[model samples]
Structure formats: C-alpha cells, structure tokens
Target: MVARSLLALCLAAVAAAHGDHGEQKIIAGPLQSLWYNRLPGDGGTQADSVFSGISTFGRLPYLPCLSHKDITYDIAFIGAPFDTGTSYRPGARFGPSGIRQGSRRLNLYGGYNVPLETNPFNSWATVIDCGDIPVTSYDNTYALHQIEEGHYSILSRSPATDADKKGPSLQGKTLPRVITLGGDHTITLPLLRSINRAYGPVTVIHFDSHLDTWRPKVFGGSPSEVASVNHGTYFYHAAQEGLLRNDSNIHAGIRTTLSGPSDYENDGYCGFEIVEAREIDTIGTDGIIKKIRDRVGTENPVYLSLDIDTLDPAFAPATGTPETGGWSTRELRTILRGLDGINLVAADIVEVAPAYDTNAELTTMAAADALYEIMSIMVKKGPLSGLEVEAGDDL
Candidate 1:
C-alpha cells in the first residue's frame, strides 16, 4: 500500500508539471478570473463589497474636479479639511475624512431615498466626490483663499446636465451644485464667498446649536483679521462681506449660552431670524419646517449649512461644540425632507470630529445621513430656478 501511494504521488506531481490533471481542466478565456469584472475606472470590482474599497462620499466616483475640468458632473461632494477656526475643539480638521468614512454604507442598501421617492445616486444627476481641498494648517488667510478658490474651481465647471435642463445656474449656462463636508464651520465663510460669486446673494438656512453670527469683537476679538474668523463668527463675516441675503436667511436649532442679550440682537442684525432649539418642544417639527420654508421662500437660491451639533449630543457627540436639548435625528431628517421643492443651490454638513464619538461612530454617521437627506431634496427639486452656469470664473 505504501509503494502504491508513492507511485500515485509521483504521478500527481508529473501531471501538475504538465498542467493536465484528470477531471481538472483550466478554462481558456483570459484565464477565467474576477479581476477584470469591474465597470470602467477604479471603482473596484463587483466582488469588492462596500467595506473594502476607497471611501469617497456615498462611495461615489472620486474625480479631481479642480484639475479635471473636462469631466462634467451635476453634483459634487468636496471636503474642506480646515479646522483651525474651532474654538472649543481642534480635531474637526479631520471631519472631511471622518464624514467620508461614515458615508461608506450610504449606497449600500440600493441608494434609495424612500421619503423623497427618488434615488439621488441613480437619478438624472451625475454625482461625484471631488475629494478634499488642500488646506494649510499654519496660515488661515492663505488657507481660506485656497478653500474659496478650490470651491470656485468646482463650481465654475460645465455640468453634465444639459444647458436647457431645469436646475441652478448663472450667466445663462447650466451649473452644478456642491455638498461640502466640513473641516469646521469656518469653511462656510469661504464657501459663501464662492457661492456669492455664482449666485449673487443666497438666503442661508443655518442649522446649529449656536448662532454663528457672533461678531469677532463679541466672541473675544482675534488679534488679526484672519484670526477673527472662527466657527462662532463666520456668519458675521459672511454678512459683512455681502454674501448673505438680508432679512431672508434664517438660523435654526440655537441653544448655546451667549455672553449677553446683545448676541441675539447682533444675530438679527447679521440677517438671521433665530429658531431656538427649545421651540421644537412647543411648535413640533412641522412647525419648524414651515418657519424655515416661509423664511427661505421657494424662488431664490438657498444655501443650507448644517452643523452636526444641531442634533442632541446623545445622537451626535463628535462635534466641536455639543449643546443639550437639540433636535432629534428623526426630527432633523423630517425637517430636511420638508424643504423638498426649495431651490437648494448648495449645502454643507459640518463639525464632525470623529475623535470624540462613541465606538459606533454616531456623529459622522448622523452627518452623512443628514447629507443623504439634503442630497435627496436637491435631486428631487432639480435647480428649479433657471440660473446660468459660470464658465471657469474664479472670482
């Protein structure tokens, strides 16, 4: 029996060397592999599931829109990894990546948005992730300019949608929209500047636990002009820069303690009507939604900026500032859905500091899902206003 086993082993080795084993045939067509089974580009193969591939927002195609002007997309996700402006926390600079990581499962369940009755990722719009803007950690002035220029670079591109398409635009051309992932709330100032260049002045729907319109002086003035722009004071600068539409913009979910009553007065002067966090208890989500819709109207371009801290800390703890008694995740999602037909030109989800989050990654996940809702509304109401696109203007 031992001699028979040895002879069989020798024969098997000889058959393996000759690539001819009984009942084990090799298939011919290109070596019969799964490696080439993917769609075009680096989007990974069909075998590479959600948890494995590169993390782009919603697992969308990552295009470097800044340099690749030829590639047209209807909507883009750009990350602003600048958190130097945070007063309470310093780690939100990583918010962009954290938000992207949280967004890994966004398209996992077939990318359907049931409430809006549409699938944004598979709709008429061509969505892509433009990666993150290169921001400097040392210099605020140059960093802000980089952010503004980076945002404008993407904003000025020709959209994949047709010129005659019903969507946002400027200068008689079809323009694309962007959803910015926060480095911190300070990035909004530069973003507003970029948006102002595209659409004259837009009404802002500011959702946060604190009113961000605090004057630099009120917020304990910064030594330099660039230093003056923090998460708490960007809206003030935005107002001063004429980027905000007066009496039309609104701030919801405010619950933070202020230095004095003058803070509210100043917030008003900065062109915002406050909807305090406590009001959700009395008026309910629909009432809050009505207030936002009424204040923002449906005609003009609207920029919705949502800070993660807008949700109660229990729901989203990984933010620069956490305030109690904020809206629940469900309530905020409902409110966002209520703004379905509004002319949402651009929007942002900011202040997702993953370092402070629980092991469940609650904050970044909430931010990503909120952005999903925002994208749903944006896609549902395809640039209802007939503004034209800007052809590569970086002003």
Candidate 2:
C-alpha cells in the first residue's frame, strides 16, 4: 500500500512537470506592436535564426534542382561530395557541408558586396541552394556520372529572369549558372564535359599549386581507365576529350614540384599558360589580373576552378596538399574581383577538407569568402551570352 501511494505521487509530479502539450498562448509584451504582424529580425521567421535552422550555402532557400523541373533559378549552389579521386588526404568528401557551415555568416549583417557593387541574394537573379548530389562512395565512375548529370541539369535550365534572355547563349536560350562546392579537383573533368554540351569549348582559369594536366602514365600508371581518372590527371583527360578552348586557358599560382621540364611542356600542350606563385612578388595582383584577363579575353565562355590549396598552408592548411608559398587570401580575392567583365559561366572551388581545418575554420571560411567574390562577379555580369550550345556531343 505504501509503495503504491509513492508511485501515485511520482506519476502526479511527472505529469505536472510535463505541462499541457497544447498550443500555449504567448504573452504579448510592451513591444508587441513592433513585431505584431511583421516577421522577426531581418524579416525572417521567429525560428529562422542562422544558428538554429537547417544550414544551406549562405543560409539560402533550398530546392531539389534535379527533381523539380518547374522551379527555375538564375544561380544555384550545388554540392558534389565525393573524394575518392584525391591523391593525398581524403576528407574532402565532406567539403560541401563543411563549406555550408563556414558560409553561415555570409550576408548575415547585410547581403552586400561593396567591392564589385552587387548583392547576389537580393539582385535581379533568383538564387537557391540546391542540396548536394547523392554521390556514391562505393563507385567512382558512378559518382562521376552523378556529378556531371546534376550539373548539366542545372546548367541546361533557362534563368528565372526573362530579361536575361538577351545575353549570349549557345543553347539559343539564356541558361542559369551553377557555383559548385567541390569534392576534389577531379570533379572538373565531368564539369567541363557538361559545359561543352552547353557551350562548345570554354577557357579554363585554373588556380592551383600543381598542374592537373598530367598524363595518366606520367602521374602514375593505373591498371584501369577508371583508376586513372584522379585529381591530378583529370585535365589531361579533359584535354584529350576536347573540353577546352586552345590558346585561351591559363593556370595561376602554380609552384608544385614537377617530374621534369617535360611536365611543363605537357601542361603547355594541354593549352595552359602558367603563372608561377612566386610571380606575385614581382608582378603584383594587378599584373596577375592582367595576365588572366589577357589570356581569357572578353568573348569566350570561361570556367574558373579554384583549388583551396592555391593559398599557402598558413592561410588554408586544411586542404589535401598544402604548399608553403602561395597567394594570400586577400591577394586571391583581389585577383577574382578584377575579372569582373569576363564571361564567367560556371565555377567551382574544390579541395576544402574541413576535417583538417583549425578550430577557427580558416580553410573553409577562406573558401566561402572566395566563393562570395565569385558570386558577386557572376551577379554583376548576367548569364553568359554569344556562345552556341553544341548539340548531341558525346562525353
């Protein structure tokens, strides 16, 4: 009887602690008029604080770009989270989410980019963060196809703004641009292939510490073709497959040790003009900008691929391969800002391995800021025009 009485008292206390599970009324305070019908701060929801909500790139709205054909956007941020192609460290598979986490503070205070004078989020374009591609870790070939198809799906769509239709287009329609959060440098091959279908061949502005145009036999002999496709040699495959425009592509910040002078010869044959990292000391950022602009020119559709390791280990130590002497974050951002009028179609920032990042998230934050600059430029210059999308091109 005593035990039963104690159990009854405990049950009563638990119920009281739980309280009523119903719609409870919120007491309107003295300042209720300020927020009565209006949404909370920044006009976002009451529960839409950056620290609490589902994280997307820049905390932008999420859309299933692949599944939904009806929802059109001008710019879409997509994640390709596969790192099997990495030659050195391997945590870049989580690069997409890590970049999103680092981008939380973007546009939080105010979505304005003063340098280029364009606000991507609030501009004429409809921007959305399309969630990552569902790439399988078990199969590299499958993952490659997945990333390519996901990119093409977004690239082939017409922009939400009908006014953008007057711009240059190979498809005869103004298509939306994609800013891909990368898995590794190897992802560039499929991206180029997709871009080829949309715009015959594009100038590549590659920023990295190493030349990625190594022949598979030169990089390391692979037993199979699939095995040969890796971060270091994808550009070789891209060149062989005719995804690049000759005499226009350029590589910046290259300081990696090469096998021999033949490697530089091979890089040149692949249609890339090299700008060594040490050149920044003499040429300055402006010189580097002039070289890139001169090489890429003002007409052709250009693809900008920035590997996080292009920054020195001191600034971006979390990447797969860190070189000691590289461009500072500010220097790289300044270079990017200078390429404002070029026809930049689609771009990617790859090799950001957040597992190797410091508590400060230096690498991921730097990558995010670099992307912010790229976004600003793309917004400043609308959809790429004057190119024709080659039809029925085999990949």
In lDDT terms, how accurate is model 1? 0.81
lDDT of 2: 0.82
Estimated TM-score for each candidate: 0.86, 0.86
Report how far off residue 29 is in candidate 1 (Å). Answer: 26
Clashing pairs in 1: 167-383, 168-383, 169-387, 169-388, 170-387, 170-388, 170-389, 173-388, 173-389
**Residue 334 in candidate 2 has what lDDT?**
97
lDDT of 1 at 306: 96
Q: Hey, what RMSD does candidate 2 come out at?
A: 10.5
For candidate 2, write residues 176-256 as lDDT tens digits: 789999899999998998888877777899999999999898886777899899999999999898989887899999999
For every model shown, the clashing-pair count is 9, 6
- Across 1-395, the per-residue lDDT of candidate 1 in tens digits comes to 22223334544574576552221221212101111233335544345466776788887766567766666677889999988999987788889999988988887766889988988877877787888999999998899999999999988766766645544444645678889998889999999999988777789999999998888987857777877888999999999989898999899999999999999999888889989989988999989999999998887778999999999999999998899898889999999899988888889888999999999998888999999999998888764335433433321
Name model 2 segments beyond 4 Å from true: 1-47, 163-167, 385-395
Query: Which structure among the candidates has the greatest lDDT?
Result: 2
Q: Which stretches of candidate 1 lie above 4 Å from their native place?
A: 1-46, 164-170, 383-395
